[model samples]
Target chain A: MTAFQPDCAVVITREDFSQDALQAEIFACGGSAGALATFVGLVRGAGPNGVIEAIEVESYPGMTESSIAAIFEEAAQRWSLLAVRVVHRVGRLEAGEQIVYVGVSSLHRREAFAACEFIMDYLKTRAPLWKKELGTGGAWWVEARDTDTEAAERWGL
Target chain B: MKIDVLFFARIREQLGVSRLTAQVEQDITLEQLQLCLAEQHASHWSEVLGGENVVRAVNQVVAENDQVLAEGDEVAFYPPVTGG
Candidate 1:
């Protein structure tokens, strides 16, 4: 099997985020002339309708990594992407915590922008992670939204 | 045989269990497991696993209805992911 790419995608616990990893990823892309764009998704202590008390995320270990790798590969094939990074956190998270990050570098802004968006859309609907929300009365699982499905389908995946 | 069944996010909250050991028929398929689980819960499980869109994973890999099973495998059922 091929070695995992250092700057491609990562799934780790919240405590593992480091400045060094981010910088190393940026440097590894070797895109001095390209524009780098990033998107960071934070956890909000609420669901679609109300304030969220807490959220729990779960995933299938080996499968999660493979699926994410495939998503990145697809994104790379579809756009003029130079480098892409995706980091997702699993476990208990509170409001305002970073949940996922997507970074892309390309010769032009369009590919970087589109690749970032595409990775996020694929992650939202296709990834195996699951999330539950805790609120005032009790805890509940967040329902799948049609909007998410639509966004993912827009990529034809 | 003993298989690990996992529920996550909403389904876990609803069922109130994270994982459990289940004894299912040999060569069980994902569809059969869902039906059996639904029946075991007096059909309450149907609320989560009944629909066509619900997703399943076997041994940490996303699977379809015809996926085969073996002892000691991990099976998970949950709704489509919405996380970023």
Candidate 2:
């Protein structure tokens, strides 16, 4: 595995997160990393109405980046993390759009996979991003699922 | 002491305003501030912010109800996170 650059990109943009670009970022570090694990969250088209029209993501500006950075730091402490990249989109987005991207690099596949998953789990609850599902019926703000909170709890136990 | 209050997402929609300056004669806990806000408007304000799983933040960090507030603090209220 190669070294994870000391710099971790924690961005909350309205643009797309290119997988090819993210892959290049990890490889750019050279031989210090052997495993690059990535997770891409896409907006699902299927909803109760059969098609999700759009999903609006909201974030606490000043807190969003700092909170995600803290989550990444915790992941690094729990695992052997070489580098990390997290980019989340806010505002109105159409179905099938990429919602989030989480990439982690480590020396081994196991660590890389664990770190990536760990970061994702933490992001679900710890980050200050909120979601609102919109359709013909009107807009509904998404609530945190109990299953997600449970998933975060398991990490400590 | 005066503090800035911020709202987001559903809470913002319910309250009908995004940001407001709250005047506080004295320091108060986040819980107290929430109650004060609820009293300012109709009962729905309390129903939203005081609702279950509502999250609070002070100065851009997650905070508990017991956290004390100070002058010029930026406090935000919103629902539970639903991001991945």
Off by more than 4 A, model 1: A1-7, A16-24, A31-33, A45-48, A136-138, B40-43
Per-residue accuracy of model 1 over A2-55 as CA lDDT, tens digit each: 222324766656563654577467668685526777888887865666888777
Query: Mind giving the per-residue lDDT tens digits that candidate 2 earns over A55-155?
Result: 99998886999988887767766777777889999988898999999998888899889888887888887788898888777778776788888988889
Identify the CAPRI category of the predicted complex in candidate 2: high
Stretches off by above 4 angstroms in model 2 are A1-6
TM-score of chain A as modeled in candidate 2: 0.91
Steric clash pairs (candidate 1): A45-A52, A46-A52, A141-B10
Model 1's DockQ score: 0.67
What TM-scores do the predictions have?
Answer: 0.82, 0.93
Candidate 2 displacement at residue B56 in angstroms: 0.9
Return the lDDT, model 2, position A18: 91
Per-candidate DockQ values are 0.67, 0.86
